[model samples]
Target: MRRTLLLLIGVFLASCQSGKDQKEDVKQEPMRTPEARKEVVYQVFTRLFGNTKTANVPWGTAEQNGVGKFSDFNEKALAEIKDLGVTYIWYTGVPHHALIQDYTAYGISNDDPDVVKGRAGSPYAVKDYYNVNPDLADDPAKRLEEFKALIDRTHAAGMKVLIDIVPNHVARNYEGKTNPNGVEDFGAQDRTHMEYHKDNNFYYIPGSAFAVPNWEGGYQPLGGEKNPLSDSRFKEVPAKWTGNGARSVQPGMNDWYETVKVNYGVRPDGTRDFPDLPEGYEYKGYQAHADFWADKELPNSWDKFRDIAEYWLDMGVDGFRFDMAEMVPVEFWSYMNSAIKLKNPDAFLLAEVYNPDLYRAYIRKGKMDYLYDKVELYDSIKHIVKGYGWTDHIPVVQKGLKDIEHHMLHFLENHDEQRIASPDFAGKAELAKPAMVVSATISTSPTMIYFGQEVGEPGKEQAGFGSPTRTSIFDYIGVPHHQRWMNEGAFDGGQLSAEEKSLRDFYKRLLNFTINSPALMGEYQDLHFFNKELNAKYDHRILTYARWSTGEELLVVTNFDEKKSYQLDLKVPQELLRKWKLSPGKYSLEEQLYGSVKSELLVPAGGAGEFRIELQPLESRIFKLLRP
Candidate 1:
């Protein structure tokens, strides 16, 4: 009787399950991808990073001084950033800057607190790569802890962190001593250690004045209106020092940066008249920091440099944004890459090689994972939008990708370049949302968003080397007043415009799409771009291109013509893409859909209403193939 009852119950349950299963069929959602695939950045100038001072120490002036302590970083503002869904937060000027006796290299102290006019100079002049600039070290070790923690939070929340590092130059503010392992003092000692020489500096051109700072108005020009590099006059008065192989190298062995110009020679015993040591030890430059081979002295400098990098990584550095990485010897990078890989293989090493043309040089060298795609920005402005002529450029864009196997790190704005609102980035008269949106999704390398980029960061001209230089005025432009932007001194406060909010949200949405879309993350999808032919007449304008990743294939078509759409068709891998093309007759890509979709299709300009896919005159789109 029990068996009979069980059989009946089972039959009833099976009948109900069958009925429920027929009701509705659901498709499983695709795996969510990380932000790295279509990354964006929020760049912060450390001096102008946030609102509050690092520590409670008084900096002497509210607007003029640099952020005081290493521990004072703004958190409230960062919280909002977390929501924006950007992948990277790059901090510039974290290490101490260069300084003369006291005054900042430039005297124009305006709205920024981290300027530290009389404090340290700019972050570019790296005094000690290991020492965190005291101004930004709000919580000392805790600050770094929080920094790395921020990366963790970012990654957990879907993001990455990158910090700027200057490898080519040392801050004049370093305080390290001349003895073994050198104890760092900062700014004052920085002046005593940092020097500029033409030749020994470039590695390629050490003391040849090869790197004359193109002192635009923002920076102090090299002395005598002549770069210590350009003019050899400065080399006449070199410092006479004993340690660090100061004199062992040939007179012209080091660059101007390495040789310090001294007022007088000093003896090791504290006497005014110093003696000549191993070689004809003349005071070519003094107080000018220089490095020597392992045979010269202080066999630990290289290790120290490495240690600085390791310290940051261990302290929570997600990645390093190397400053002037091109100038650093390739051998050093080989060591860096090997070591960094051993420490953390995923650690990102983004070199600041602003020139896209120079991309190969840096990539060939080890230790680098990414570099700027400046050419794209230039093309986006001059040809893609301005349409000065090279109207339908597709080939050029394609060739640019030959060197890169994966994606490229693309950007429209950063600390060094104009923000999105800058004239160059303003592109067309209309809001080219489609253009930018498509670019963000389709570009080869990952994307980096400038700090104020999402919200349409405003730019205002301040003094740069006595001339006016424009920068983002987040406080003046669209922003809402908050403590982080106001009295607490955490960040530049401002209200967000409707456009900014919408743009920001749209970007977030786009990221969300990429994260969840199986079509986008596909490795089989290939990248494509529209560049003018090599021998074509007007080669300067128009950068039309596309990238196919995963299931979604992207094509970016821009009418650099500023006013009109430079209409064009695409060249696809017919053999591969044609397999999925519409039939020869009555074939057409109607609206967003075509007659019949296939695994691959080459929509060239024409075929029974087919083959060629027509791009809107001034717009672009990323096509996701729905395999039939």
Candidate 2:
């Protein structure tokens, strides 16, 4: 009997120890904030959003090819946009720019066709800072009111409004008819006799008269239309430096000749004429930068842009997208963006800075909220999508910029890039699925999509002044594929084909999941190297990673192959498994993007965990591990 009692006691002790081991193995990870929302910016060229015309005539007049008005973004249209998981709507080309349309009746001077780009002028060449584009208003007299109402409508629809702020330059004819009582137009008080001055807003070529560029390749103002203003002459006594810093009296066709460069107290000899930022200002926040500039004397150009930004902020603009931000000095942005933040602390200041070396300086010292990840991430993905590069290069790019990944916004399509469905790109919108998945979930950065990218806009129309493979920002033209999604103002996919509908549904599902997933906002670990060394079937065309938060763990895998299927056993390193505190057991792997797809994850004792995954061509999966 004593022997039997001792055996029972030994068995009880063994059971207790086993229970303790199991408890320790299944220790829960610390809880984290699950509602960390990722910003999804929808950049809609304001002039192209609502135009349902399919007549894509090159160099067509606004009368021939209908212009989309500000009123076109009605409640229904906004609802459709908001339903796409968009947090911000960047209303591009909202400001008054130099266009060919004559608004002389409204006390606005007509832009010379010799200087303007197309029927609709370049949005980068601003003519007035205080007014909205007259072409966008249903009634030209109430243009500002119409824009304000649009702002209200956008806010009511649960999204903020962003407009462009062209600081580096303005139209060659910088006329601001709607300037406020104390605000003067750019270059109004400039000393034209000298080439450079501390307060001069523009640099002038002394004793040189502006001459029109010799139009080549049969290109003419308005496609050789015989408007009175199309006489190929502009009245300027002293020719200013071209927008591209060209000093010739007449700029070449390739130069940015439609606009003139804005002087920011920088001398021709590269000497800064303005006060420099104090030492250690690079590590400061916007408020400190604002405070530092509050009492300091600044250049006239700096104050001018700050006033223009504040004016728009007062008019309910939530943010500004600075055009060619790298062209302007970083010091100027510190002052301008700080002033913007002072007015509205939550203002989103996105910039177009292409230089990778200048990215950190712009974001840190310039106080910019986000910069385009075009050169690194976007370029790499473009090559991969074109079937030229390897997915192995992506992890390298991410590791290099891991510190600033949140500030580096990722985008598959934007106004500056060719459409994904274009023959020059991937030739099919469906092929971008894996690329989009990687772009949206790979980091904690904002994801941006141009207006018609979801609908497979090929952008093949040879719109005037703009080449094929890119939608025209200069000409008055209709976007064919986007118009089908527009469905004649119903804002529904009434005219979309089955393939198009499926593609759009895929985008909607992925984007919504991105904003809602906590793991995406949490920590990221690259599993590409781990799998490449373990799984024989894994190739350079495949990418794998893991992301986890308190209650969510996600394994993201993407296959960039256009014609191959990958059947491989993806392994998670033992170190990461320990970091996740995943005990040895069976867990359910369920897909989050599309429902009803699942697999199993088997974690054996004292070894790397793995799951058998089969990826079809251009397929991506975000599998969530259902842990016990």
Query: Which candidate number maximizes TM-score?
Result: 2
Total backbone collisions for each predicted model:
113, 0
Position 20, candidate 1: lDDT: 15
What does the lDDT come to for candidate 1? 0.41
What is candidate 1's lDDT per residue for 507-554, written digit by digit as tens?
Answer: 555555544444344333232321233223223334434344444544
Provide TM-scores for the models.
Answer: 0.60, 0.94
Q: What is the C-alpha lDDT of each candidate?
A: 0.41, 0.86
Candidate 1: residue 267 Cα off by (Å) = 26
Write model 2 residue lDDT over 271-382, tens digit each, in one string: 6766667656766778899888888777899999999999999999999888878777777888898888878988988998776766777777788889989889999999
- Candidate 2, residue 204: the lDDT equals 94
On lDDT, the leading prediction is 2
RMSD, model 2, all Cα superposed? 14.3
Task: Write down the worst ten-residue block by lDDT for model 2.
Answer: 15-24
Indicate the worst ten consecutive residues by lDDT in candidate 1. 280-289
- Tell me the deviation in Å of residue 36 in model 1: 8.4
